[model samples]
Target: LEFLQKPWHNGRLLRSKGYFWLASRHLEIGLLAQSGKQFQWDYVGRWWNFIEPSQWPRDEYRLQGIMAKWDSVVGDCRQELVFIGQGLDTRVLQRELDHCLLSAQEIAAGPLAWQALPAATAFDTEALSARPTPPMAVQPT
Candidate 1:
């Protein structure tokens, strides 16, 4: 919402989807699926970085790839998304999205503190509603 404040006048954003790390959920990976105005954030899984290395892939090459993406502070956690559109102002989009990210202070406060905030995330609500609930069985008289 913050990233796309104004609708595109010259071009349209066709699609955007990817896995990203949220400062609020430091260990979990979030999948952002977007098509036009409708977009959803779903929990993908926990970041490999947070798990024990013994549970990691046995392949050395795969391990190397993961390590390569690792950051000194956040490890492999990062914001990775793809945007496809025509005549897009990428610079402006990037800047706006960056602004939506948590500040240094917020990030430093850590996930525990983030969880303490009331209604701090919309993902949980949206995800729950998106699920298909099963109908209750009725007893025959």
Candidate 2:
């Protein structure tokens, strides 16, 4: 929030939006959308890390596919946001967001300590469960 709320490039920000993982909620993905001075975050869903290998879709590529994007320690948790505006200083934006990331000591404390921090967004499993999971892409036999 501090990043978006602060005046940048003389208040030239037009839009910014993307998905990111918060240290506070390692399992859940956060979606950030900002236009001018307003922005809101929504829960996108859980990373494949939370989904047990046994529960993964039968599609053969499922495991191989996600592996390409996964990290040894954090699985697929990452910051992937884009900023757009006139006269935007990308270096400052990157530095600011990078500073917000968890440190080694913080990461070592693990999920329990991380979860103790306040969640950036709220999501109800009941509501999410009511929505159907999209069918997997068909693989050639």
Per-residue alpha-carbon lDDT of model 2 for 7-77, expressed as tens digits?
Answer: 66543778888877776656766677899779766566677777676766677676677777789976766
lDDT tens readout by residue for model 1, 5-116: 4566646789998876665555667677899879777666677767777877779887777887788877677888898998889887788678778777877888888765
lDDT, candidate 1, equals 0.67
The true-versus-predicted C-alpha distance at residue 134 of model 2, in Å, is 15
What range of 10 consecutive residues in model 2 has the weakest lDDT sum? 132-141
Candidate 1 minimal-lDDT segment of 10 residues: 132-141
What lDDT does model 2 reach? 0.65
Off-target runs (Cα >4 Å) in candidate 1 are: 1-10, 35-40, 116-119, 128-141
Give Cα distance to truth, residue 119, candidate 1, Å.
6.8
Candidate 2: stretches off by over 4 Å: 9-11, 60-65, 118-141
The TM-score of candidate 2 is 0.70
